[model samples]
Target: MAGLKPGAPAPQAITVHGQSRVLEIAFSDGAVFRIPFELMRVYSPSAEVKGHGPGQEVLQTGKREVGLLGLDPVGNYAVQPRFSDGHDSGIFSWDYLYHLGSQQARLWADYERRLAEAGVDRDAPMAAAGGGACGHHH
Candidate 1:
């Protein structure tokens, strides 16, 4: 998928399927994806999850119980996720979301490696990490 240009219209609809743990995003440009919540959480664009730069990323664990509580639009380019556990800071831009969707496999593998190094289970209870339980931004 090509990168989304700045100022382009954002997605037309974003739906969270609680039972499937998937987020369905439909863009005005006709791209659509049913992204799993685990994929979204593990690939959150927040600095806490993405880190300040490459190699600083913190792996997310215990996010199996997490869910998207709501989606709040941020201006014209991004959406703020109201996570079920009350996390609402990450402003997921259209470009970022698309990138994550395109690079899901690589990102998931990296996240799994980090979790292994941290001795954490991706589906277990949250540990006492600096960030919130699931490691997303506060």
Candidate 2:
């Protein structure tokens, strides 16, 4: 079986604009993006963000002002993002990050639609969904 190769290093530039909740990343590939923190928060690759199975996803709400508290490397393939709200579970792989950078608009729009359907506001205070505030079913 063929194994996956190690991912590339993180972008050289990462700027987070707290006021706008946007996290901008400029990759070596010359791709750049300004992804909203709310968008990142909702679409976090963590199990806490992405449920174990299809249709099991828990909607993330009240995260309009979320920010990245820290970024820690997970070996050579991914980076773990620690959110200011104390969420740190997802290991964002290079591929995942690239996808987010490319599909941000669509993902964000879907997230918003889901939130609306659930009667949740992205800017309100968050309440625990699965277990603890950071617990997710993966």
Candidate 3:
């Protein structure tokens, strides 16, 4: 009866830093995180990014300069981030945001490793031979 009660974590300030290509979020718990747009894009919660299930994840490559186009409220429980890369399906919840912030360094490293293993570059434009499909440029 002396600890914090169960409740939704509140985000004090959420900002899209275009200059730095990062999304800054400050929590009520006094934690502040500057998450790179590229990171969010690669780790997007959208089915397109995460896929319908494991082992089907589409590896997102060449998003080093991604930008945050906008953030919209999704029932006060989460925010939808629209990226300059045209990805806006991920609804980042408060808990997920916190996790991203806390685990950023490690997650990013893993992503880099995966990219290297896949022979991909973070800044190279991604192109695949998919007929009539939108390709990633830059």
Candidate with maximal lDDT: 3
Q: Clashing pairs in model 1? A: none
By TM-score, the better pick of 1 and 2 is 2
Q: What is the lDDT of residue 64 in candidate 2?
A: 72
User: Model 3, range 1-138, lDDT digits (tens) per residue?
Assistant: 122236745789998889999889999889999998888888998877775567667778878888888999887668899998788989888888888999999999989888898888777776662522333443
RMSD to true structure for each model, in Å: 4.9, 3.8, 6.2
Residue 138 displacement in candidate 2 (angstroms): 12
TM-scores, each model vs. reference: 0.77, 0.79, 0.85
Clash totals, every prediction: 0, 0, 0
The TM-score measured for candidate 2 stands at: 0.79
Q: Candidate 1, residues 1-138: lDDT per residue as tens digits?
A: 344576664678888899888888887778787778777777777876777778777676777778888888777677788787655668788888877766777877887887888888888765565554334453
Residue 94 alpha-carbon offset, candidate 3, angstroms? 1.0
Model 2 stretches with alpha carbons more than 4 Å out? 1-10, 18-20, 129-138
Write the residue-wise lDDT of candidate 2 on 16-116 in tens digits: 77777777888877888887766777788777767776776778777776787777877766678888888889877766777888998788788878878
Using TM-score as the measure, name the better of candidate 2 and candidate 3: 3
